[model samples]
Target chain A: MSWRSELQALRDDGFDVLDWLSATEEDDEVVVTACLVRSEDPGSFRLVRSPAPVESVVDMFPSAQWHERETAEMFGVTFEGLNAAPLLLPPDSPAPLRKAQPLPARLSQWPGEVDPAKPRRRQDPPGTPWR
Target chain B: MAMNPRASLELIAENCTSCMLCIRACPVWCLELDAHLEVDESSGRRRSSLALDRFSIDYGTCMMCGLCVDICPFEALEWSSELPPTQFEWRSE
Candidate 1:
């Protein structure tokens, strides 16, 4: 499914609430999943998904900004129109999720325990490790 | 920590991530994110843009399931025992 049309359809359904959006890379494509809940039901939901990155709903749903950023950062899919700077993955790190033999960092969380009070020191430090 | 269900979040200074996840997650969109994030000499983080200006926990409209707390990755936010003293009047709708 085209990413744009699918997202547009979500807009048509009036999915004003964003639940969660995540992505995974296939051999040659990235699949993005966006879940939204109906305002009336709140918890009862609908999910809008696509296997392509060409279509984008970042314009229709302003909140999709972060979703697209993380998707592009981790899965390497281009959101034809989203322009927000990357929110997670380091500014200088190469997107490793796109490689044929992607490194564990692409799928792995920081190696050490995460201390809520301390700075994150376990994530890849940058310099485009896989690029 | 089991907090009072009738609590207000004013003093918690629950800084919004501007990730807008709360707005996205809010069933009522009552949680509004505005542009008040800025440097505060009190807070020492070099980069000091906090999320929304201030979030109102519409006591009448909130659903106390802790979803808001769950979505806040910054830990700048938390629930409190009582509503902090407010200077602005709340909107009546």
Candidate 2:
């Protein structure tokens, strides 16, 4: 079965709800992702993701709510979900399918901490009258 | 028109530079830059529907998640002073 079919089958096996969905476009293609979980198996969950063009598995999951909307705006993927609106974007947005576009400044660049032991370049402390 | 009474709507249009980052970052589809988005006749590229128009925030439906301002590549969005302001000022290298 194809990825969409696999997702539908998984839904049939009681994975009836969608938790969220996200998409990222690469140089070659778009990647659509879905996170699935059910009430019965609260802790256990699975992720369904693939490169576009992705089929709308929205029919199988109602809570796919914002997930489908997000995928549409970020990657221009259409979903059979209720409405494909700017979930994380404005309706008047320009082409969102530019995979090479830089990520939002706040969302880009992971900053890690510096190693503590590597430094000994401390300048003299601020002047105090007592010193 | 109906945004949460609690959320503020402010637009810094000058800083917008006509980039649609705010337009593409709203989760609730509440932001509208009233512009003529047209398809380029020759290139078929989807260009602006209108020229530069003021952006509207539909508060009646807005979730006020701040994602719109967060995704704006330009500093075109003004924050509500009530909330902690996160602003990015661009400086030339």
Candidate 3:
């Protein structure tokens, strides 16, 4: 069945769109998830996952427009049928949230293993690696 | 290490290199650092370093996760047993 068919089935079964978002995994794969809340039980939610290059469901659910646009901007995923325009980022800006994107050199201390008592200053402000 | 369990955060501003690891590790994102690069031409070797103008952590939103204390490469942040004053004149700014 098509992705739209799955969403329509959920809608027919009395489910409402709660939230939609996408994330880039460590392996460089982008995954989009949508939460559908049961109308009778607001506390219960069903999560739906779609890998990158999936079809857009904005036609079935208008609320998914912004979410699809955001996923496209961050992960470079094309949401077919949605407006192909930058949502939260500028047009000239690169994909800053992609897993493979280059990061600032200063953020190399992510592991927290470096002792704080040492002077780790580098010759360059944020380009050269600290000794 | 022997440390006061009830102490708040202690910061050694001069030792900080403004690497921003602590800022990213912070769960609440309460720590803020305003820094810029400057060149030191006085010495034979011209070296550029970051000049931190303002470094403030909002205790109002801080959860004291201690990630900043552990991740600082320069031992610039520490935990002190003496907490900040409880009473303060509330300002709108």
Best-performing candidate as measured by DockQ: 3
Residue A1 error, candidate 3, Å: 4.9
Over 4 Å off, model 2: A80-83, A95-97, A102-131, B1-93
Docking class of 1: incorrect
DockQ score of the complex predicted as candidate 2: 0.01
Worst 10 residues of 1 chain A by lDDT: A110-119
Cα distance off (Å), candidate 1, residue A43: 2.2
Tell me each candidate's RMSD, in Å, in order. Answer: 17.4, 20.3, 10.8
> lDDT (0-100) at residue A110 of candidate 1?
26
Residue A100 in model 3: lDDT = 59
Off by over 4 Å in 1: A97-131, B1-93
Which prediction has more favorable TM-score, 1 or 3? 3
Candidate 3 chain A weakest ten by summed lDDT: A122-131
Lowest-sum lDDT 10-residue window in model 3 chain B? B84-93
Q: What does candidate 2's lDDT look like per residue over B1-62, in tens digits?
A: 55444356467655655455565555544555533333456667655333344456657656
**DockQ-based ranking, best first?**
3, 1, 2
Q: In order, what are the TM-scores of chain A for the candidates?
A: 0.64, 0.62, 0.72
